[model samples]
Target: MEKPTRLALLKEIAEFLNEETETYDMMQGALKFLIDGSDFTTGWIFFIDNEGNHGLVSDTNLPGALVKNNCQYMQEGTCWCVQAYSNEKLTKASNIINCSRINLATKAHYQETDGITHHATVPLRSGREQFGLLNVATPYTKSYSEEDLELLESVAFQIGSAIKRIWLTDQEKEAARINERNRLARDLHDSVNQMLFSVKLTAHAAKAMSKEEMSKNAFNTIETTSQQAVNEMRALIWQLKPIGLEHGLINALSSYSEMMKLNLNVQVDGLINVPSLIEENVYRILQEAINNVKKHAHTDEIYLKLSQQQNYLNIEFEDNGSGFNINHNTEHVSHGLNNMRQRVKMINGKINIQSSYEQGTKINLIIPIKVD
Candidate 1:
């Protein structure tokens, strides 16, 4: 036999790896490239799945009688490929009948009427990772030469590199998907939920107390309820107001309080600590709790307290006007109550609202210290 040109072989293998974009196409092309140019009577590409079972990734035109009679069955245990990869050794079986190195599966499948087969296989391995085996066999009772073994090893190397590149690309795509989910999760908790809470609190308070009632007690109930609605509006507005909340929650809250004062003359006292894990949702929850005081308490003077406790942080916004029952009053704005519930739950903290129709509203928050 004439010696095969090394340059031509390398060029042919490079084209095989670079030419195919899809995975199965690459497998089929690589398998056929090895079998067609030579006179291998029967051969197939062995594919190993995650569960370690082996099957034919693809098989080109081999002798019909050999494979169709299921002469060499298409599926078998993955042990051959596994051992090749695991040992990092080249496997050469001269005659399947007399070959003792290979396990029974190979003999049971490939041992034909000719008594045995000859094949050489090298693990398609790149770095320390092995994808499967590249193999070629003939139904003749003869052994493969050392030269044949060396050539197939080169082919296996090319196949392994291609498998690694394909695997890497898939991992990158999966990582991108996870990052997108994290950003969307933050947005929903901060912006969308806060606005809806304000709407609910205001509507409920308005329904419970009458616009028609003129008596002082009746009018006070309406006033307190209406004010609670306005405060929730402040909370929602603060939450929806800025993309600049990353400037720090303190600045955003202070700016919002200034804007509300011109219209309602309600002073906002805010106490805030730097947030853990991006602070965006924490800011929104605090804003919702404070506005509850402004809207429902109807106080001209609201006190803000910000302090940190070991392993926990506290934010207090209190008003000295009309306080409603934290548990019982459906009349004042509790619209954002549920929204705050969600935000705090993410960080494993809790919110407290204390007040009644005339006692004034005080909002307190206790959140865990989760430093990003």
Candidate 2:
């Protein structure tokens, strides 16, 4: 190709690949056009960045793509493109090197055009910056022309412009996601958790100053109201901010031990060991089970145990207090129990309640570790 014609091709590329959103796909189609219209069979595009690393951008009709945090791939075994990149060569290559496979890639990538044999890759450079690369390869020993190099450079200018646009768009989306998470955290702390604390304080005061004195009826009412407030706060804490197991299930359970002792006047023990995500769900389920014990079961003594068995984590919560009919409608228990069921479903677990009038309510939560 003549100099005037070569310059015109670059200008044409700029016009076609300049769109804001279509840059990535434009880079993809441009590589295909270079091989099909120019003197090459297989084409690979790469960008040599500030740190002298290869960043594979796009390819034509290939299955495996090279994954990169920020780099490209080298095709020549001795890496002609690296040298061209370092030297900032306008257009150059070895006749012998083009006839051989470019094992110059740092590692074997999924996008290896296994059928490619002879190849030519041009390092894309603009002053001190190495933007990207463009190349054409063939299975036969035929030599590529100088005309091909000029055309590849033309494609490089357009493809490089498109790549820069893609990078900017990605950066914008990531920044937006970070901002959203920050806003969510602030809302939870400022509104939800603070209100729960106020409710807890008021309930505790009512329990203490109530004129129940020693009357079982008035005393029981005061105790139940305070306990209900505490349970509500526990659920709110779990929702507002899920503690990342820094405070394990045992710590969460221990906080409730005094309540079991005071309300039912029973002895309770808790054991726990499991992975973070699954175990967190277990903590929530047990908390709800304890709330149920206080609200309706009227049990004097309660037992809560958590430990890992063969294939699953077992949670046993038993109460010696007045048991209720398990067959009775669970609609009234929807808030806590339903929430537990929904959470258990997410972690692939099961909850079994065994109780009737005198039998006492025992909640068994089994969470499977190995889920498909």
Candidate 3:
């Protein structure tokens, strides 16, 4: 490509990156723009998280061999470029010594390579933080000239900076969300919750003072309604600002169980520190489990065991109560159980529930954890 043309393409890519907020879309669009505007016929980008897990985020014009099996080869296993980037050796744009995925494709007899044997790899980085790799390849291209490498490096820098910006923006948004939730929780607790408590107290006093049956019934009804409202407001407040979560998950659950006046037997095997997302979901699930037991299980005592393994966190809840058939109870299947399943699925975790009539219930949850 000509110098002016390359500069113009870079300008367009910068504009696209600036306007794009979604990471995957930004990367896929940038890859397409790079390949379509330059001499490169194929390109792909990889995203390496803090845990060193790599994912093929975007690609353009992949050959049949690489695209086979839904891009299995590219998605799995380490390649030369990835290893070099991970080891801090691939800081700038340079030709890969060999393409391992291509070699494997050739060995598997997927002959539609389109002469693609090597790729120019550039480490996507912004200052000190390393993101991943950006690779561009053209048919029959053995090496990239210094000027070409410089251009690739410049593009990679733009991509890396854009990614970092997006991540920071997301974090800021999340922090704002949490702050707003806490503020609302505090306001509700101070204003509406206190008012409901006062209403309950006044109604109770009025009921005791009234001598007429009709007057007593009216005051009694008012007291019951205000008490129920107070309980519901407290539940909402807990959801907004999970009690004792800042200390730990166990503390939060124990606090909730105490509020519910249920006997909670807790057993822990390992240290419990998890991401906020996981911790919140687990707390909510257990909270719901405790509520279910108190309402439907007809049991005052619950057993909970939490254990942390190398790459998985396991939690179990057992209650010996009036269990119902899982397959036959449509209400149970559709409500709380469904919500628990959705929560587990949201975090890429697994949940198992075993219950039978008069046999009690056991719930097991397994969540993957990224260890630093």
Give the candidate number with the greatest lDDT.
3
Whole-model lDDT per candidate: 0.58, 0.57, 0.84
Cα lDDT of model 1 overall?
0.58
In model 3, what are the clashing residue pairs, if there are any? Answer: none
lDDT of 3 by residue, 1-372 (tens): 453488898999999999998777888998888888888899998876544557787999998888888888888888777777777777789988688888897677557888888889898887897878898999888887887788899899999999878766754665576678889999999999999999999999999999999999999999999999999999899978887998999999989988888989999997877888678778878888988888888888999999998878899999999887887776854598877875664555668899998888999998877511
Candidate 3: residue 341 Cα off by (Å): 16
Instruction: Show model 1 residue runs off by greater than 4 Å.
Output: 1-6, 19-22, 47-55, 62-72, 77-116, 138-141, 145-147, 193-372
Instruction: Report the Cα lDDT for residue 272, model 2.
Output: 46
> Model 1 compared with the native: what TM-score?
0.42
Q: TM-score of the candidate numbered 2? A: 0.42
Rank the candidate models, highest TM-score first. 3, 1, 2
- lDDT, candidate 2, residue 127? 37
Q: How many backbone clashes does candidate 2 have?
A: 10
lDDT of 2: 0.57
For model 1, residues 1-372, the per-residue Cα lDDT tens digits are 543475566578678788665556787887776665554544566755323545567666644333543434445343444444445453432223333323343544454323334455566667865666776775553667666666677777887788777655643543454356446645654665555555556555655664555554554555566566556654444444433465766666666666556122233244445443426556667566556655765655656666765656777766678776666666435567776765554454556667767777766777767621
Residue 231 of model 2 has an lDDT of 67
